[model samples]
Target: MESSVFFENSEKKKKAIGIIHRVYLSQLKNSRKYLASTKTKSEIRGGGRKPWKQKGTGRARAGSIRSPLFVGGGVIFGPKPRLVYKKINKKERKLATISALFLKEKQLVLVNENEFLNFDQIETKLICQLLSKFELEEQKKILFILPKPNKKFWLSSRNLKNVEVTTVTCLNLKQLLKASHIILSKESFDLIKLTYGQQ
Candidate 1:
């Protein structure tokens, strides 16, 4: 799609770099699952019995087998499940998304929505042919923005490792930044302009 007039201001372009970086980092941080967990000494099982007598054993005074120093022991300061969140202002996020779109304008392709409709049968080759027509067959990552979900289109594109399909409402900063090429249906492009361009 053509670059939006909203992004034409040189001053805005200059400031977009910092905003985009901040939003990208915020989205990345917020997406983390943070599910790593390690057992502490008290939490470890089978540590109830002392390894040996404290003084009589030839080896050094013994404690529970689950001591951190032991072979199969509890971790001292291992990672625990926790949340990491970074919040960005609504306006800032919108600006960052717009900036990302502006940066990727050259890689953007606008297609009529009808071209993706009336699939007689689901086929991966059809999607491949569509990409070939756009000269994006070799592109590593392509993002498809649809006005709404299309099961046939989604199914046809799912097998491709490098293609992603998302609606305008579900679009996010990370996806926008990571995509090497973005394909937008005419309706989807208009929706994005309506949502992110007025400001």
Candidate 2:
């Protein structure tokens, strides 16, 4: 079906969230880049002159071989800097976000419109209050998307590793999938739509 439903042009029923779990999930999978096979050379530790002649020594061999003499010999195979970002179908990525939007409609997501002011303390109590009021206290993994985090907000939430925070522009494909609850500011959501959605 058509996906160009603008706020002004959307019909009553068409102004609804779309749910396509498999399409969403497949998109996420396609974006993952596996690096298990990367190889890297070890840094040089030491390599001295030959201990003895090639055949005069009683050892395995008498040579100026760096690999044999140095404890930090070059690794046979190790991880190296390789392309970590995999490709995802554009249609699939859009559809996945549509699915997330569907979840958002069902009280699964929280959008904070107000700007954070007092954040000197571990604003867990304030965030807890916000979530409790929405009956979302039980939801553990909450993802917060912002244009950029205010220092106070970052400090307040940094202690809680489960509460992930990221920029709207730098949203993590993996974290989005794992988060039970997705929280975005009004400005952040608008920014996302502006960047990836229709104009």
TM-score of each: 0.80, 0.53
Which one wins on lDDT?
1
Q: What shift in Å separates residue 95 of candidate 1 from its native position after superposition?
A: 1.8
Compute the lDDT for candidate 1: 0.83
Task: Pick the TM-score winner.
Answer: 1
* Predicted candidate 2, C-alpha RMSD: 7.5
- Model 2 regions more than 4 Å off: 1-61, 65-108, 115-122
Q: Name the runs in model 1 displaced over 4 angstroms.
A: 1-5, 47-73
CA lDDT scores, all candidates in order: 0.83, 0.57
Residues 1-199, candidate 1, lDDT per residue (tens digit)?
4354656777877789889998888888898899999999889888899988888667987679989889888999999999988878988988888778878888789888876675557898988988898888645899988888788889998899999989887788888888999998778878887888655
